[model samples]
Target: TATGWAQGGIAAAIGADDAPSLHAADTEAAGAGLTDPAVALRVAAEGPRLIDWLVSLGAPFDRDADGALALGLEAAHGRRRIVRAGGDSTGGRVLETLVRAVFATPSIEVVTASVHDLLQDENGAAAGVVCERDGARFRIRARAVVLATGGVGALYASTTNPRGATGRGLALAARAGAVMRDLEFVQFHPTAIAVGADPMPLATEALRGEGARLVDETGAAVMAGIAGGDLAPRDVVARGIFQALARGRTVYLDTRGALGASMPTRFPTVAGLCATAGIDPARQAIPVRPAAHYHMGGIRVDGTCASSVPGLYANGEVASTGLHGANRLASNSLLEALAFSGFIADAFDAMPPAAVLPEIRTARASSDLPAIRAIMERHVGVVRDAAGLQIAVDGLSRLAETGCDAALTALMMAQAALGRCESRGGHWRSDHPHAAPARHTEATLRSPGAAPSEPARTDEALAR
Candidate 1:
């Protein structure tokens, strides 16, 4: 579960001095002008209630000395509005809480299997899914299908996401003729622990909020000439670290001066991770580098979490609701998922009965992941240029023709990155280096390996 790997807490305006509007302002500021104000406001207003809902399910969130919820701070947030659990083990604890609640419910059944494809009715609406479990293929027909399969960080060689984060849901949506929006906006965390590990360990952004610094060898500040120094928006910090590494400088997250001896209790997750890498935060600066962390782009969905496909829905990292826009605000990922879950439920309940499911055979081909990862890491990484992006699009297109879902998703991402022709938020183009007009990128697959001629653009928020 990628949620279990999240060390930062959920952002919510629960403080007495804070309001949802203030929270929305900070979100919009971090979003680089693409975040929908209404979406931000609605999600912000849902924060306190969502926290309450989690508490009712025994989430065991951390509390201050007064027994109220302990609120921490993160980058780009103006207030101490991050609600956490067990210090830095918020995601693990929350996952445990939800699992317990889910098991307690009688209507749910937990299945361990891989969904290979979606089944559609005669009218082209989603109706079911094809599943494979223990070497046996089967089908489970349903009225609707909701994809929550997470982000595409695993497409890159260096990432903090689990290996399974390969954009499975995005591929599923695209193959079903659903719109994908801003597939280029991949967020790279500036502080992935660089100790020669695959799927690198993350040093949460909250560490910087607690006064950590980004320094290179000889204690030179890596972000010295940059605005906001070590506490800038994620994209700025990532570029700083990336450019520093490109110049043969070894970057480090100097937490020795910040948390130090209190690291174990304050951030035991990162402390334990550092120990495995043979680093002692109390005595040494932690070596770090930028790595793919999250995706602000996904299947285009409306306010109700409904996709262009009539009976297909999306939530969490799988759906683009125009909240994150060009970049996602720190700690807002978990909050967005929580707020949208209710909207998805309401949409599902009001839907008409599903049409008869048509019998459709589905098959999946093994992907050459090493080849795909190498292309993405070299061409479409933290920094991008037209020549490299064109190379990526060409390479990925050939793999997509082989019926590789991972490759199709990567090709879409590369196409979107190439078409944008400007640096904005997560999609930085070294050739362009500056943003043009602000507009959302919309695309859909007409056929496998077929690229859109030009991406559609809209300056306003996606339709509600």
Candidate 2:
């Protein structure tokens, strides 16, 4: 789990009835970021089925007063597809339901361990995983390995992700030679409660969907002049907040007049979080700042959630299925995870019998995570320039001397971000602050004794 918890409220799962339009939103944001349009579209098209499957698994969903599906951001544009449970604790409720289902299944054995690396067979195919539990290392061999270790948010100082979300799956896959796509595109949530917490608490975008406005300390609307205002795409909203912060203005989510009396009922989770932080949404504006939230890029996978390496699979936030493109639509991640998990299961069932397991031995490398986090926060954050990116690349390269997987992952992202000269989606380059011809970045780990290389940017025309 990314947050060391079964559920994290990072994104909503359901979407509106117009799945094709949602697909277009994804394409517009991703803009040549996806590896395959067909695969991405299939995942989008499966949204309804995935929601139905979750409901069948005992997941409880909430309906609006109109008896319509309550919607989350982006999807909330003109349709209702966002559903919740226990007010704002939708992810928690869904996770609890799934955990119970897993517990009921006798064949499944849940192990508590932190995966450090992947094990490969003599033919270079994935065979198992290397994990550490309670300071003891062990190897778990399997016919098929799924990397769902989650995102790389912990690599940044100001992040809304759990401390455990340090890109372990990405590092393991890259080291094992899986091709990584879009590592440069990391999405920052626009409204993380600015209460000085290590893992910042989120102020869910659903609040804005329900009419809460973003404003500065002067009681001026921060998103006033923007076309969509508070209802803009996440990347746009996040940038708006980032710019406000840059200008020494304190940004806030003002729900007072909009959500006023209904704050606690409509957003119990956020209200609780606000209360803990000594703010009342009903009486005051909740202070907020942008925080590193989600990664739009990861270990690249195909339609079946299969990585480049046979016998290895990835799902959830760990796999860059391209459904999100450069910027992910709100709540689509959960849908993708559920939809692809089914696809992976079917693919696994059709696979040939596994060959004899191979004996493999590997040691986990330790990382100076705090140092890496500081470097990333300083150099590769929401906005980037050539000098800062170069500094980050150099700093991470030096840290790579420790043989740290986390450092390697950071280095990969910095390298890719540095190479892409144009500003697009979450990857904002102050130097090149305009969209260029759309392109996708692809990277592979270097072979021993070979010179390290930057990721290749595939032109949209050539990729298509």
Candidate 3:
């Protein structure tokens, strides 16, 4: 199973007073109009059903004494409908349970291997993934390939993703001539634990839902000036933290009075991590700052999770299914992944299998891992502009000129980051501060045979 360092609960319209329409509207607003209205409507409508399915599969979401699902409000939502597994430890708890269920299922096989490249047939249809594990290489051929390998958060210097989230799937898909979308829009979590750990552990946003306040070192409220304050949109909050850091002030999320004695009962993971770090949230404020958390852009896919290439499907963080748009609402990433996984699974199972054919020859290529990671961290990081993006594009292009498969992935991210023009969501361009006229720009890198005329800046075309 794939792993993520996600800390937020899955958002849904499960609250008694919440409706899918309201949730969809909130999502669209948070997505800044780049959201696909139809996708938003569909996901929101299916929210409750998906939640019910997850619960039935033994997700064990937290519930009140009356057996009603407990909900929490995250940064971007109109209602408190985020279903938690155990307070702020929702992602861990849910994934652990799902992993157990998946392991128990007889038909499913879990392989612990890292996929290096795609295995394609003579007709250019995807057949399987070439992977390596413990010094052994193997090809796991299947009728359909699902890219649930998560996001590129690790491309940044500081991120909240597992170390494996190096945009491998994004690069792999790109090299296979599959179209990628919106690779530029990255969502930085506003409040990662700032005690100076690499890939800094997170301080869940649900703390804010429990009434934690964002304060400066002087014990004064820092979010009073913003519209939503502590509950503002993620981008706004991240920028706020950035500004605070720029001024050399320590920013903190005061959870002392907010959570207090009930902290362990609500967020055991957070409590344990804090304790390990010599902190007591019930008694002191926790230092925090922004860190790369999610990628709003990824491999472009249709409504059914079909990529540009035949027989290749992508879901979860790897696929840009147009549900999250420019900025993903808090907790929606997990929901999107689950929803698309279901869609891809059902769709793949229903398709008739192609006749067995001879396997295509596979190739191994060199990778400049350090160079690609450095380039992504520098240019496509928290704050971006034209110059840095161009530098990133140039650097990746130089790497790709070496004819390595891994370099091609870096090239894809660089190209897409360069193409997106406006400062929408987490892709804040210093040159363009305001949101441009409403547009849904999907980040796409051009194939050799594709059009080369400035990448066609049209609604139908990909962003790059």
**Tens digits of lDDT, candidate 2, 314-390:** 99888888777778767666767778889899998865544555454445457899999999998998899999998
Ranking by lDDT: 1, 3, 2
lDDT at position 349, candidate 3: 65
Question: On lDDT, who's better, 1 or 3?
Answer: 1
Clash pairs, candidate 1, are none
TM-score of each: 0.95, 0.90, 0.90
Cα misplacement distance, residue 168 of candidate 1 (Å): 0.6
lDDT for each residue of candidate 3 in 1-464, tens digit (9 for 90 to 100): 12435567888897879999988998888898789988988888888998998888888788989988988888778789889877777777788878889899999988887787677776667788777899888888877788888887666667777766777787667666787777778888988888877768888888887788999999888787888999998988898888888888999989886485578888877787788788999898988988888887888899889998888898888888988888888888788877777777778766555434444334434657678778877777778788998887777766665445445655666666666677887778888777778665554444522221222221122333
Which candidate would rank higher by lDDT, 1 or 2?
Answer: 1
- Candidate 2 residues lying further than 4 Å off, grouped into runs, are 2-36, 65-69, 72-76, 353-360, 448-464
lDDT per residue (tens digit) for residues 1-464 in model 1 = 38888899999999999999999999999888789999999999999999999999999999989999999988888899999887888898998999999999999988889998887777778888889999998888888888999999999999999999999999888877888999999999999999989999999998888888999998999999888889899999999999999999999998884486788898999999999988999789999999999999999999989999989999989899989989999989999998999999987877776778755554646789999999999999989999999899878877766567888788888888988989999999999999999998898875522322212211111222
Top-TM-score structure, candidate number = 1
Q: Candidate 1 — what's its lDDT? A: 0.87
RMSD of each: 4.0, 4.4, 4.0
lDDT of each: 0.87, 0.76, 0.76
